[model samples]
Target: MSRSYRTVHIRDFHDDDLDGIVVLWEAVHNAVIRPVYSLAEVIASCQEDHAVVAVDGDQVVGAAVGRAAHAQGWVVFFGVSAADADGQIAADLLDALERRMAPLGLAKLSVLVAEHDGRVAALAGNGFGMRHTLRYLERPMPVQRRELDVLGDVGGRILPRHLWEAVAGMSAEKRLLEERLVTPLAHPELAERFGVMPPRAVMLFGPPGTGKTTFAKAVASRLGWPFVELFPSRLGDTAGGMAAALRATFERIGSLEHAVVFIDEVEEIASRRRGDPPSPTQGVTNELLKLVADFRDGSGRLLICATNFVRALDAAFLRHGRFDYVIPIGLPDAAARAAIWGRYVPASVDIDLADLVDRSDGLTPADIEYAARRASQEALARALRTDGGDAEPLGLADYVDALAATRATVSDESARDFLADIEAYGRL
Candidate 1:
């Protein structure tokens, strides 16, 4: 049995669980979800937002992932093994997260479930409000960066050269870029408009290290724009400098008129326009207020901003039209974790992490990839040193050690606390 009856623990995902997570993700979503997305697209979903899993005995039976933009949230992927002992597991998981979060003081939390999916009942039972239809749009990233400047001939503007090369180098993420950013914002004209505009800003919010930075580069490369990166530490020297610096950022992007500007970990800048520390300020808040106001009505090239702390971001900044569509750069769900696992691990290894991956609850792609890389190194080290360089290929135990080496050491209590929110809210 995949589930163990004695325990169910929820926590952030660890690096080693990539493979099993992917399998469960594909299995549940593919079976129950309507409006099926491309396998690439579907896998990309794993990389967005945050999620939680359920376990009973040794088997994993349920999961729930929620992504937020503005006041709305997409319960993008969720399902329980209907055939598993608890067909109601999806609902139970989500219920747990909401109960945990409600006391923490949030005005609203939203989720989108498959309309026809019985899982909607899980949300309904939890007091979720119904909303409009939503669809995800995407396009391919250019294969090479465009060398020509913005002034180049119109036909020569296919994909700018530098941007293409950056994207091309990231094989898997490149595929995601093509699907999520490049395709939707394919044209320079569109990028410029999106970049310059304020209210309808383009936002990339996801779990940490999901290549939001690379995705930003892909946008810049695809659009042939000059890219500017902003650091949080620098933004808030003085509250007064914020508006001016932001204007400068806008002006710089506009100067290129075809450029793309990126601000990584922007939540810091907003929360720290005054940069005193973690303390929030009226001055900093006001500065952000003005910038967001101006940006919605902005004109010129594209602007891309990314933040790992989506929920921590100010609500005023998230209002519709302030940012056009807030895209999620979530953790690598199961399939993406699988792809990451396969891409990084050699097939010659005899161990399969399917069991571990299934067990892992909330690891990001980067986390999983790092574990794989470390595991491979461990195997090679054993082969070269302990086994006189004739050590057999990596085995399950080698993979297990690799996993143990990288796995997060979460006390059982802490794991429960971190996962308390998701278990209450999402039905994954």
Candidate 2:
């Protein structure tokens, strides 16, 4: 007997839906119409690509999977159970999948189906029209095998997509970076038409815990390139001296096709040179300066260096032609503070968000995160200590207590010093 359901709900595809999808695929295959995508392809897209499913209680009745390539979106899989063949499940799944992929800025969505597929009616009902028939094409990925080896050797990785959007607040910083860095890099041809040269290297300076490193990674993620972090301390681990090690590392980095190389706490190696006998880091600093000059000569790469103390850097290092921009990343502003707090606060908790934001005024993003986590810990402890299991949602009192106990990372003096540095050394 065919089963009937009273209601069907569409949702994101979960790992547990694997079995249901397999059954659906088999049913479609047995009906004399094979899907253009193989089972393996569909399964991979279901996991790694964007997908949505229609579920009736515990049963997955339908699914749609999609993959975005450049400006096009491809439907990798679309199927529904035999019982719901004439129902609205298929349309719902496709709509949900499109909604999930809407943020990718796709210009069009297209799908391939067998010439004699029986489900064409459902697609037509959903506003899809028949376009010119063409043979499907396949090719290897853009990153070749040799490039993978080079990336692994240099300890580089491709960050997840959409990290730029994930960065909550700091609209001013985001806007500046987007215009100065991302726009030119992402649209080099457009930039060239207006007599703009994409920046090759930039420096981010601020007090500790100001999220300079986060912005660097987010830039790499936004550019869809490999992120490689060069550690000054680790350079000493090799057989040669730190200077030689630094040179060798850059030589290896030169082989990669594209990369975003980052060096944090650059003040450690690029500090001012002094004394009659020149410091040990003087050699390393000289090597780094030369490396930066060479790294700029190439294309398809960006170098981001961050430091807590911008004033400690060698004066020559800040000269023109070396770094394109010397941007300051200060503590969280009012709007940023509110966004950071909202990210950590639980939805079930009933706390005054504006009050928390007001109290966190001079705090860094890291400082706010610490206080929020501390608040949760205290709330859990309180619930455990009360008798009769007197459990209640976390309140403003818990967060206020945590805030009082938390030590702010950036002091008033340091905040003033940052402002001074911005005035003296800031370049955009």
The candidate maximizing TM-score is: 2
lDDT on C-alpha atoms for all candidate structures: 0.55, 0.87
RMSD of each: 26.7, 15.2
Best lDDT among the predictions, by candidate number: 2
Q: Provide the lDDT at 248 for model 2.
A: 84
For model 1, where is the 10-residue window of minimal lDDT? 150-159
What C-alpha lDDT does candidate 1 achieve relative to the native structure?
0.55
Cand. 2 Cα-lDDT:
0.87
| Model 2 lowest lDDT segment of ten | 1-10
List TM-score per model, in order: 0.47, 0.69
Score residue 50 of candidate 1 by CA lDDT: 53
After TM-score superposition, the amount by which residue 118's alpha carbon in candidate 1 deviates from its true location, in angstroms, is 65
lDDT of 1 at 25: 64
